[model samples]
Structure formats: structure tokens, C-alpha cells
Target: MRFYTLFFSLFIFSCSEVVKEESFGDVTTQQPSIIPAIQVYASNTDTDVKNGILYYKDTPYSGVYIVKFKNDRIKSKSQYLKGIKEGCTNKWYADGKKFEQRYYSNGHKVGVHTGWWNSGAKKFSYHFNDLGQYQGSLTEWYNNGQVFREFNYVNGRENGAQKAWKANGNIKANYEVVNGERYGLIGLKKCFTVKKGQDKVTR
Candidate 1:
């Protein structure tokens, strides 16, 4: 399990100038292809095991990859260099619905990232800069396709009015965050305000 999780620690950087921070914990170093002749995994075939590890192959990588499930279903795919995910990474649900679509460069998430419900409806969409810090606007929707939450971020920290809507489309909550401080209604009411302390926020 630890080894499996290692591949995913792939995203880490400060909200501000994340790309400048680089280094995140123990990075996964690319292992040179030692068994190039080994057949890559095929969805229609049995699971391929190598050295007690699950199926993995180096199929003329050329800086791109498309992963698959044992059933021949596409699982996830991405482009990367030196073990760092670059360009676009895409994944799908077992049912064939897109689950996640994101962009990255040099291991730091950049551009837009989107997710969808199993039913194929957009679930959430957000933007991040080349540094991997949340920027611009972010929004999420209920499974029913109703707006769930809307907010703005700056350097990964909430920096503007944030609003949430109930499934009925009614405003549920509202607030504003500045430099990590929260201010506005404690609940959905239009009145009342509070100020919370500050702390670093991340995606």
C-alpha cells in the first residue's frame, strides 16, 4: 500500500509560487527499463505480475502513456517526464464516465482541472496556475446538476466572495476570505458576520 501511495504523492507545492518550491517528500525516481521484452498488460488478458508488483510496462514511453484495466477498459493516462506528470492527465470511472481531467507541468498542476459525476454531468471545475496554486474561480455542482458551491481563490487561498447553494437552488451560505481569514454570515442568513484567524490553505 505504501508503494502504491507513493505514486500519488505526485502533487505538492506551496500555494504561492508552488513551482518555485519544487521537491515534495520522497520523489519517485524513474527506474530504467530493465525488462523491455515483457509484454504490456492487456485488458482482455490475465493480470500481469512482475516481481510481486502489479502490472506496469515501459511501452516505448516517449513521454506519454495510456493505462488500462484488466477488462480492457481505460483506467487513467498521462504524459510526464522524469517520473513527473506533465501535460494532461485523464481518468475515467469504471462505467466509462470521465472522472478526472487535469493539466500539469513539471509535476505542478496547472491550467484547468475538471471532474464529472458518474452520470456524466459536470461535478466540479477549477483553475490553477503553473505553480499549482488555485486561482480565478472554482465551482462545484450537485449530482442533480445544480450549483453546489462557487468561490474564488488566490494563490490557493480564498480571496473573494464565496457562495454555496442548496439543491433547491437557494443560497445556503455566503462569505469572503482574505489572506485565509473568513468573514460574513455564520450560516445562510444575510446578516451577522465573524472573523476567523488565518492559516495557509491548499488544494
Candidate 2:
């Protein structure tokens, strides 16, 4: 099962120049990708900077970046030390079960994010915009892989009317909501089926 989560952070640089501060702990350097306009913003051991700030300008990267370490066996990983989540960050439980996994964007939580519950019986997933809004394909599922509920948004709020399905493969009902209020041609019955999927299983 896959779960999604969203997280954000604010990084305020004090001056015009970026400082490279080597993070303390046992960090294993993974392969760095060929970043386009090569700009060595900062390093872990720099006198002028108090922290490391890695930046990007349009090129793509492929690899893991081990930045901070809690112990010799594990490390805190991130895709963008400066900004942009190029990879994934994962955490493990004491029982050897994967506890969490979060993707990043410029170190901010942006895009399709998923996670698990403590009971391990349910799964959760959500979407986010760059500035912090649930913006895109958002969905949830039961432990057995059945969809609990699935939806999305443009800026925020349902972009269109909410549509439900019936087992015979038809539109069960459609509701148009505005300003969190339901109104106008308030409801419609199942009469059509545009395409097919699990949504069509009974509809």
C-alpha cells in the first residue's frame, strides 16, 4: 500500500551569498547528478555560511543525497539540499517495517505524497501545490486496496461537480458545490457512463 503526505519549510538566507555548512554526523555521499549551470552554492565546511544551500536552474538529476545521519546505519536523505525534491526520503520502524516516505520540492512538500497509519490497516494519500494547497490527483484506499475516496482540486475546492457511481455502471448522482454550499440543479441521477474503470465496476 502507498500513503501520501505534505510538508513545507521556510529557509531565509541572511545575505547575498550562500554559505556551505557541513552537516554533522556520519553521511555517506551518494552520486551527484550532472546539474546544468554548475553553481557550487555552498558546502558543508564553509566559513561564510552557517548552513548548506544547494540550488538548481532547469537541469534534471537522478540519485540519492545523504545529508544528515542519526547513526552509522541510517541517514536523513533529501533530493534538494537547496530546493526541489529529486528523490525520496524514507524512515524505518524499530520492527523493520517502513514507517514513512515523503517526496520533496525545493525541500518543500509538493506533489503526490503518501503514507501509512499506525495500525497498518489503512492507507492515506494526498496532493499538494508548490505554494501549499491540495492541488492535483488526491485519493485514499482501504487496506485491501479498495478506493475509500478519491478526488482533486485546481487552486482549491472541487474544480467541478462531485460525481458518484452506481454498481450498474452509471452516474449515481452529481452535486455542484460552491463556496462550500450546495446549490443549483442540486442533484442529478445516474444516467450515463463516459468511460470505464473501478468506477465502472458497479456503476
lDDT of 1 by residue, 107-163 (tens): 789888899899989999999987999999999999999989889998888888988
lDDT of each: 0.64, 0.46
- Measured by TM-score, the strongest candidate is 1
Superposition error at 57 for model 1 (Å)? 8.4
lDDT of 1 at 20: 24
Tally clashes: model 1: 1
Q: Using alpha carbons, what is the TM-score of model 1?
A: 0.61
lDDT (0-100) at residue 197 of candidate 1? 28
Q: How accurate is candidate 1 locally (lDDT)?
A: 0.64
- TM for candidate 2 is 0.40
Per-model tally of clashing residue pairs: 1, 26
Residues forming the 10-long window of minimal summed lDDT in candidate 1: 20-29
In terms of lDDT, the poorest run of 10 residues in model 2 is: 1-10
